[model samples]
Target: MKNLNPMEVELKLALAPAGPAALTQHPHLASYPARKQSLTNTYFDTPQGDLAKARIALRLRQVDGQVLQTVKTAGQGGGGLSQRQEWEWQVPDHELDLVALADLLPFQGQLSSVLHALAPQLSTDFTRRSWQLTDGLVNPGAIGQRSHIELVLDEGEIISGGYRTPIREAELELKDGDPEALWALALTLSEQVPLRPSDSSKASRGNALSNQHWPLPEAHSPAEWLHRATLALDAYHDSQQASFLSDAQQALATLADHPALDADARVYAQALPGGLDAHGQPSTAYGNAALALAHRLAYQTELR
Candidate 1:
């Protein structure tokens, strides 16, 4: 995709069944007023799903009587920490101008041909209520402590070909402050709410519903697990309920809790390294220890 705009960085967290309610009751979010809206969004792709192959998602959304088109490029980081390219334009009517969108994200040699091939593949409808935090009362001296964070609670469903997938997730977006502000808020919210670290997006779930198939994620190796933990920790500061954290911790545990890994954890624990907070304990750095151990644990009812 051509550089139509700057990267959009959003932190998406999965909520337990009661997660939305917890967010609403959280003192910080509760203090802020909420803005609510119902959104109906349709995703478009070619008959062969070429856009999906390109790792791009095209969406047309109607919110409060106005229609807008958005194009989001491939994910740049793990789910917990997401950065991708995005472009949006107002739609005057029912038409989705492929030629115009192609200019923003060129695909193949004949961009026009590709654009003309797109068709509606999946859609989602949901109500979103969001709160913005700007006051520094939460943390007066932390990094990006004075920045703004927009937290959203979405409750809806993804519908395609008579199939439906429920959507209930909380999203954290940095408005105009330091990146650290995002994590600080997330940590505070997670402390009160049952937030699960998640990376799935509505577009992805919609695509799965449309195809009548879900993408099965491959299990990561010990090293890869460690890498995921690293990303999650870096992005959200080892907050809480990160799914990858358990496996990562087990993997590190396999190598004598690995002397090196343990040393790294010690360093992480004892030092407030630049760009990190006190929350990065790397406790999950001690996951299944090894791939074999993880597989074994998956089968045994009890670790013993």
Candidate 2:
């Protein structure tokens, strides 16, 4: 994509599913919500004066459950100090329904006026567009620590994929809503994506493998098990090769209890170190001992 001036590019907006419509229109804000409509401004700075790479956004909602507007700034690369602003207003719930939020006319005049006022600092010929897609999913886990995933599909391209957290067990992202699109992408990328081993199917088994709580298993939930197995494999790798003593010990503990090891436990157990060195660090002897333990664990299931 050619870089446009951030100031000149038009804002893109979409209303995502926030929650049940009933939850958004809770009675608490009814009386005062009408008075809250206005252009709320936020600002940021960079020594290079480039606002295009910096992100800016706005959300508008009525006292009732109606969302009036949603806006996002474009990040076209430009060299120099620049500023991007977003303007939004709440739509009255009594006057419009949820679908009205996606209508282009409601804010067309306002958007024009704002764009005109900033025209000297921005480029003209910009226009607004909208598209719809199914809502994304939140990772099923604890409160205050939820993970989210979003997928975008255009034409025949698979635009994006990745984990929401640094240490999540498994994450799957499908860009297009079409089942065939997803299937084709999966087939094309099969070798690039890691496939889980079949034997470790129980969710409860993960608890015995690592310190982290693993999600319960349900039909078609191999991702979680694969995640646990990966972590167990990581710990085993660390125990055998990491330089830090604490890391090695922790890895050893994880490996010793991992449910995946069938015949390897005995060999691993025989490799663990006898004691710490004079410097209060694990000695080479300890590393050897840990290795022995790991080998035994890898080879013998009864040791677990």
Candidate 3:
């Protein structure tokens, strides 16, 4: 297998239960054969939640009878888009290899204390169907663009002790070129299937399940409302109920004049109501707009 880049950039979308079927049958993807894999991912952390507190994740993934250990750090960006540092290597078995992990991580000194306490906390079992797109193949309109992306649909369950939650989401990883291609493909896909940008990763969701609570963010201002809207979009996907969708719609409605929203983003935001609709479906318009606003907010906030 080929090694991935140490810096991982991806856009995650929360898919409806029926999304895989719709996505696969879509005209653009219907002809291409999907590469499928059964993946079992086990997440590890210390009994005292030290790794969680440090915003680090350790995982052992079993696929094709091979075991790969990976370590990830929380980097930046939100609203279903993120960039993070990751290190992965083949390991002997389903065991924690602190020595190997230490070789890959930058903070070796910090590992001495927490290494012994590390143990498996949760696992996600899923089937991944994926396709690769290059240049303007995914976007004929933007011919000669230098962009390579891998689009995947994952379906399965997150297992934590006695608790379990379904996993139905799409991920677009930027293998090469501009990250904007991710949004472009997502926008195209969302036109046919409802999609909500996911702020929660499987690791975060597992921790939430282990703790039995998902704390909601208070939306007091434009930036906060933008965050809340993204959360509501994800929650609605999980529940498929009207209340959560309503909250998302309401939150998005208040962000037109948000200082962080640029002209293009504002236009998308304005178009959101028509896409968000009352059917509890979040469109690609909503996804890209949320991401754009979030990026702008981060950029402006950093300058202050």
* Candidate topping lDDT: 3
- 239-302 per-residue lDDT for model 2 (tens digits): 3323333443444445445555445443443333233332223333432333233223322432
All candidates' lDDT scores?
A: 0.59, 0.27, 0.76
Model 3 quality (TM-score): 0.84
Question: Model 1, stretches more than 4 Å misplaced?
Answer: 1-4, 108-112, 135-140, 143-145, 215-223, 226-304
C-alpha lDDT of candidate 2 relative to the true structure: 0.27
Task: For residues 167-249, write the lDDT of model 1, one tens digit per residue.
Answer: 77788777676655665566666666655445556776666556644433333443334334443432232124344344334
Question: Which sections of candidate 2 miss by over 4 Å?
Answer: 1-176, 192-211, 215-304
lDDT ranking, best first = 3, 1, 2
Better of 2 and 3 by TM-score: 3
**What tens-digit string does per-residue lDDT give for candidate 3 at 1-304?**
2245689999888876567788888777866789999999999998877777777888999999999988888856766778999888898898977786766654466766778788899999999999988776565589668888999999999998677888989999999888778777776787677677777788877887777655568876566777677777665554455677777878878777566566766776676666665566555565555555555665556577
Clashes of 2: 40
Judging by TM-score, tell me the better candidate of 1 and 3. Answer: 3
Decreasing TM-score order of the candidates: 3, 1, 2
